[model samples]
Target: MSLVDSLKDIHLSILPQDPVKIDTFVFRLHYFWTVSFILVFSVLLSLSQYAGDPIDCIHDHNIPDDTFDRFCWVEGTWTRKLGFDAIGGQMDKAFLRKDLNFVRCFDESTNSDGKPHEDCWQHQYYQWVALVLVLQAGCFYFPRYLWQIWEQGKIQSLVSGLDRTSLIKGLQSKNELQKGEIKDKIQLMIQYWREAKGTNNLWAIKFYICELLCVLNVVAQFYFTNFFLNGQFAQVARQGLNLDENDSILPILAECRLTTYGSGGQPQLTSGLCVLPLNIVNQKFYSLYWYWLSALLVVSILALTLRILQITSHDMKKFVIVYFYRIKEFNDVILKRSNHGDWFLLIRLMDNMNDVVSSLFLDELEKIKPFEAYRADE
Candidate 1:
């Protein structure tokens, strides 16, 4: 299927599991789902490197074609620097800045002594593209590992066996053992929360920090990819538009030299222009990659900021119960007496329960609110 269809499947499959997840959807998008896409693309790109000819060359009469192609693909390729004098007409292009086109090649850079200027080797990165992408996948996956290490499944443990009890459905399917176990878990959570006070905020704060890291990671990937492409990646969209003989940017034909032995064991150096079909593919692939990353950065930043906004709501815990369970008439004392961590925990617990249990959970908090408030007054 198409790439969009492939991405759609990944997106949908992860959407339903968000509620069950201990972390946010943004976290899954970076470490899990995005990693899957990059690795798959890396594998597909690697096939062309091994199974197909990465470069083709037309050599001198004596130098064999296969030998030249293999030599250039392995050794390296070079691009010439074109000064503004050569770019006389097309100076309007953004890529033609003085920093860009350098070292015109062996022919143009020859001095009065008949020597070429400093050789600028390019396209070595093309050979290692697959490995580089794998490294990038690792970058995205690291934060998840860090968060998991710190988390140690704390949220999961706190709300353990929440779904197994009859609280979700009706009293008919009730198992007293599970019911009591669920109650004990909730009771322990409540007691721990009441005692812990502001201490529990660390759990939620750690999660938020990881979410922010995902956004920062996206920004870093842009620079890394551009550097890998020899500064061509960021300008691909612009340089790509004018793909002419003089303005060859993404898949520019590169010059390669191969030295072989002749009859008297004389070393003969031959040069040829090698065609890199891989760069053609890279230009398009990374164009899509760039756009997708740009969009991901925007979404991730917004999601993180909006989440923080939700948490800052004055009546966040109370609002959760009222919005989900429509419980308009309930004791608001629990909210008045609750600490940041208590609100953080209660809302998270309620997130996993159904409306019936959520209202019941609200009621349990309501029963405690008055006594907690009364004790605080004393």
Candidate 2:
């Protein structure tokens, strides 16, 4: 229909289908979207950079092709002659942040001490991008994996038959005994949910911690990637939007040099200009990654802050319960007696279960007489 819907369809088609969603939408955004983006980018970049000649060096007329290419690609390449150093912003010399000026097809001069010139930054990070992305995907996935194991289908076990509106409608056709069995199952769910207090606050604190971990991981990944990319990965998107490439860690062109004996055994010095196509792809990938991760960070921070408010503010919790599920008629008794863990489980139920089932659950919970006394006895 629309362009947005088409894109959504494309994204969904690539994602692995799961019958049960154990996490929230923002949580899924972290582990699913972030991880998927990394893995896909990693594979694509690997294909582009590794499957062909990633670096092509146009060498001196006397130099052999194989020697120049191999030496530069394997050892390293450098931007020998840097341009005017005045960039608009603060210069980060730790990562060889320099002006975008690669003039001519010649090599840089060695220092009097035989070392590479100080201005020439060695370019060896082309092959490292794919591996870094793979590692980043693993980092993004750890929180989800831990939560999946800790969740252990607790919500699924409780919300089994109560997931759809049709469950209530089908109650009309069931035999009396069948209806009784279903009601018994609902009661069992109520019992276990109430008993989650006994079972380590319904494991609710642990789940909230996992969610917190997701947000922390998102923030941490930014700094980690910046370090990996020589302090330029996080700023790539903003810098790209401003049309600035001087400070970019991934350079487009660099210089390569090789010294070897000729066919006649005379010592020869060869210098060439290497055009790096892989860095072009790398800058694009990191720029895209920057935008995605920035959006995810804002959303996760908002979600996590709201979660904290819901836990601390009774009015906030009540508003959420009433607003999301249309459970406006439920008694206030259960809300008074329920702890954060119990409320957390109920919120999960409201999230996963159909309106009819969730409302029915609230009705049953409200009818639990003097739940405070029941708690005291327990």
Candidate 3:
């Protein structure tokens, strides 16, 4: 086998048959798309930043020289130390030269005079945001992992057995010997499930766990977006979209400060506001955050709705209705069949019903009266 096929075999051997694959909606939205988007976006963003220098000098003619730009590059990426002077509102270079003391942004520290403080890097913001997105992707997938851990093995085994049974009984040969073999196989499958009582109750528990995880994932996303993204992007997007009052407001992007200090400072740290240059990148990051949050909200709603329907389909009332419906359909087949066809139809119905209701309907089938050997027409 090729390397690709070998890897596929290894993966399948490890995971076997994952239960989450049975729920295509949840698997696609939560497990596949959500995780893929965040991680991919993070990688792209990191690559873009790494490929090109994140800081560049402004080409505005109003400034006297490139001193401010050079100072910013040396100071740090996020420090906003070079803006309008407090004494004179004008942002000219002369004012900055005289009154402005450009210190590296550093938080307050209790160190003695002349002690060195840590230098803050501007690219750290991008790094932090990327890390957060990667973490959120993992969080999004955690529930699916929980489901697989708790229920995947049993679900895969059951599904595999049903598939094997269907393959064996679906053969088109008309031989009496083959028909008898199919009947015996069908009877054995029914007896196996009948002996496996309370499996339906286990399914109910699994369904409930799936439902709870769906809701929890949604709630966690909202909380992480609001608090973890610094709420800046979400707030701005809401305002742009004219949303109602929301308590989770984001911090001002430009006004945000990082602590750094100059090499010769009195060991006293100072704060610098993020410059306008870095604010552009911050805006883009937050914009993407808003888009991701909105998409996640919609997908979570649809996935949760689908999960509820799947769970409800297994309830007692619905189960009884489906059971009777299958039986009535099976009886209709008996009216039009010879002895051989009747046996074939019965096994086919059992196989079809197994996929739908599994052991629940099979146990019910065991309680029902056996079909007559003679055809209805006879």
Candidate 4:
């Protein structure tokens, strides 16, 4: 049978056709989005580690303005990007400064720089690396789920016509088959049904995995939003703190004007480059809110891991036998008995059911051995 054309054989009518199509499409889209989100999440989480520190934005005499507006996104706000300094002194000391593309460096005169400084860098790098590794592992983990999905779809399509074919053949050949031959054929058909059920379970795993990816993507988006809205902006300007040693403001107003507008003085448009919203940053940061979010993320990760284990533990090989006979209509296949001449067909059907059930039971028993032992001990 042609690969694509064969799909029509499976009777998927029990399911709303449009919903299944929509669901399949959504699953595919989610798979793509999940992988993409993981990569982006890793990068952002790494960046956030560096940005998390509350670096003094106040340098020289001037209070660094919206240089840390970028942190607002990480803090959970998506309102607007932080404004950059119109003057020369930028908030370069802040690790997440729009201009600082690398790790933040310490100046000898900077207040936070000294013996304890090395620890800061170490913590920052470690957190960044850990989050990046998480994203990398997720990349490797998702494919097994996708493969299970493909296998299930294939089996469903292939098995749809097998039952009718077998039943029709059996009825027509009923008078010709010897008793022994009829018994053998029936046993074979039973084996096919067992195999089909196993195949159905394989598709279940794919469905579970697709759901997992969707949840992960949504969680990442939530964290991204939180980090943007609540994160601290550096109070210092790029060129020191705009102050003298005595915390005195140098007469620098004539040199630069502090306005909410851009260099041209028109309302600075930062939306094109940065997508964070800024309106939420002014709200009070609540520790409980963060705790709740962190808990949710942890729970999501655990749930996904459990689902993965469940999917992988499934025996894909079991489905191979199920699809072999390719029976689609279990109810339609009627077991027929003929005169002694037709006894052959009746015997075959009974034998097929017996052999199929026996083999499946044996296999299932093997799978339950470990669990059974544990239960017994308990």
Q: In lDDT terms, which candidate is top?
A: 2
TM-score of each candidate structure, all chains considered together? 0.71, 0.79, 0.50, 0.24
- By lDDT rank, best first, the candidates go 2, 1, 3, 4
Candidate 4 regions off by >4 Å? 1-23, 33-209, 220-378
What does the lDDT come to for candidate 1? Answer: 0.66
lDDT of 3 by residue, 1-378 (tens): 975576457445533553323443544466666666566566555555566444444332333224444444445343223333557766535324422223233333543332333421133344355577777778777767776676545434434434444544644332322345444554555554445433445544554566567657767777766665444445556544322111112212221222335577533233333333333444554556567667766776776665455334434223333463343222332223223222222233344433333333344344423323333335
Across 121-192, the per-residue lDDT of candidate 4 in tens digits comes to 111122233354355435433643555545444433322333433544545433333245444543444454
lDDT of each: 0.66, 0.70, 0.45, 0.33
Q: Which regions of candidate 3 are displaced past 4 Å?
A: 1-20, 50-52, 55-124, 161-189, 239-378
Model 1 TM = 0.71
Candidate 4 structure lDDT? 0.33
**lDDT string, candidate 1, 1-378, tens digits:** 987787568556633343345666677788877787787677667877898888888756576688778888888776653222353554434234522334234452344332334634455777888888889989898888788787777677766677734455554322432356666766676666556666777877777788888999999999999888777666665544334423344545677666667899976566677778777666666777777788789889888766665577657656656875566766667666665666666666766666555555555555555555665675
TM-score of 2: 0.79
Model 4: ten consecutive residues of lowest lDDT: 245-254
| Backbone clash numbers for all candidates listed | 4, 1, 10, 54
